[model samples]
Target: MVEQDSTFLLIIIALCLIFDYHAVLLPSAYNQTAISQENETRAESIEGTLIPSEVERFNMSSMDQDYIEDEMNYPPIRECSILEEFKECGTACEETCDDLRQLIICSQECVPGCFCKAGYTRETKGGCCIPTALCPLIKRSTVCGPNEEYRQCGTACPRTCNGIPEDCTQKCVDGCFCKEGFVLDLDKCIPESSCRVTEVCRENEVYRKCGSPCQEICGVQKETACTGCIEGCFCKLGYVTEEKAGICVKPEDCIPPKYVKCPGNETFTYCGSCEGSCQNQMVSCPTECGSPRCECLARNNYVRDKFGACIHISDCISK
Candidate 1:
């Protein structure tokens, strides 16, 4: 029994030692955890204060530098006083007119100048400003009519045929035109009898040029008023005349007009002939000459179709 009692006491003492050892280790672990937490808290506080201040200081310094650089680069502006008058000055124009000239300052010291008179522009062609209407017409080659009167190309010139006004649109060429009773044949003026009047007007046949006349015997009546005494032939609406063949054909049968190198930077495209209307797709040619010819109409790009009609890029897809 004594031996048993001694064994029990030893066991209890060993248990108590284990408990004391555990208790001692628990405080050390707790201190370590507290210390780590305190260090993390301190680090966070320092970062929050120091990092923001550093960034703020950097931004402030950059702004200051930029301000200093801008101040150094730009010159100080001086305010001019309204009352301060200089030695050099000129009389200001005080005229009130619709076509008034632009204000002119003779010198830096001068006050605001007077306005130009009505109908006058500020353009200085010679010495003084003049009315825009009074300005000389640009000296283009004068186109003379059958009456020896000046008329612009495409203008309807007056011609007396059978005591009636033959309304002829002038060509681009400038020279003395044919007389009243005569029509232009090729380059020369000739009598109407000398010109060939088509015996049978085609489906779209029409009279073109000065001396050209339509035979009354022909099935087609004159659709339009007689524009000229010339015997030049042209196709009517929706038909185009072949350039080389001089025969009226459908737009589908038209050969694409030959390209003529137009002078100057003026951009041109084929129009009027086999070329479809510059205005739209469905519109027909204005003249019988099916040959597409270069024409100046603003600026546009054109291509020929398989049917030989000149079409705008916006109207058709390019092959």
Candidate 2:
């Protein structure tokens, strides 16, 4: 009986030890699971702090948002009436008198329509816009006599009447008058003939004959020269007239007449007169006036003399 009691006590001690060991192991496993869950929750909170919220993503200021909202509600722009097609009015005339007339009519049709811009004006005939200050002058009939016409006073008419009418005014007038360079003679204009006649040469003296229609003196028939009316005193032979000094001088004292080059290397010194030769014969002046230029024929060349002239290649001077 004593041994049986001893064996039962030993079995009860071993079973208690095994139960305590299993209880300790179960608690350690539960602790590990709780620690892993806590670590996962902490990692999720760290990720949330790194990301930006919705308000920060747009990056727009408060004032910008208000402006955008206002723009959405704004009214649309209205079109200008001038941009629309024209609706013709029956009063519009096919032809207008002048710019002033057109402007009056156009203004009645549309307040600002067909108006010209600055520095531009409407043309009288076509009513087109043109550059500023280019309008044509308007003329009107004058009250002057049948032979006379109204002119723009001092602007168009002569300011002086050459002492014939000493009381002439500087204003516009309608009366009988003489043409330029003439004095009044009865009812017509005539050249002056009271020129002084002289035969002797004085210092810086030049001679000019009286103008045409001079009264004959001592039966010496007056002759007309190249210049009209040889009755006027003139420079003697070989002397040209000088207007400034009113005298005659050697040809060298006068400005030489302009000369031009002709074709075939010829120089044109005068018109209607030949100044050169090709083979001891007079070379004719070119037919063309003004410059009197002439060209050589295809088979010809120029030869120099007093003046140049075109000649056959066979006639050219051998160097």
In terms of lDDT, model 2 sits at 0.36
> What lDDT score belongs to each candidate, Candidate 1 first?
0.39, 0.36
Residue range 1-319, candidate 2, lDDT tens digits: 3355455445544543443233211121111211122223221122133212345435767776564444335343221122122223422442322433222444344232233445544334433444333332221122333333333332223322122332344554333444446444334445544322346554433343343343222112323342445543444444444545555655334333345344554333212233344454446556332322333442234444434546654565642
RMSD in angstroms, candidate 1? 39.7
TM-score of each model, paired residue for residue: 0.21, 0.19
* Cα-based RMSD of candidate 2: 41.9
Point out the worst 10-residue segment of candidate 1 by lDDT: 24-33
lDDT of 1 by residue, 206-263 (tens): 5554443542211122335654465444566555555567677664454443454544
Identify the runs in model 1 with alpha carbons over 4 angstroms from their true place.
1-117, 120-147, 152-182, 186-198, 207-235, 240-319
Q: In each prediction, how many residue pairs overlap at the backbone (N, C-alpha, C within less than 3 A)? A: 18, 11
Model 1: lDDT to the true structure? 0.39
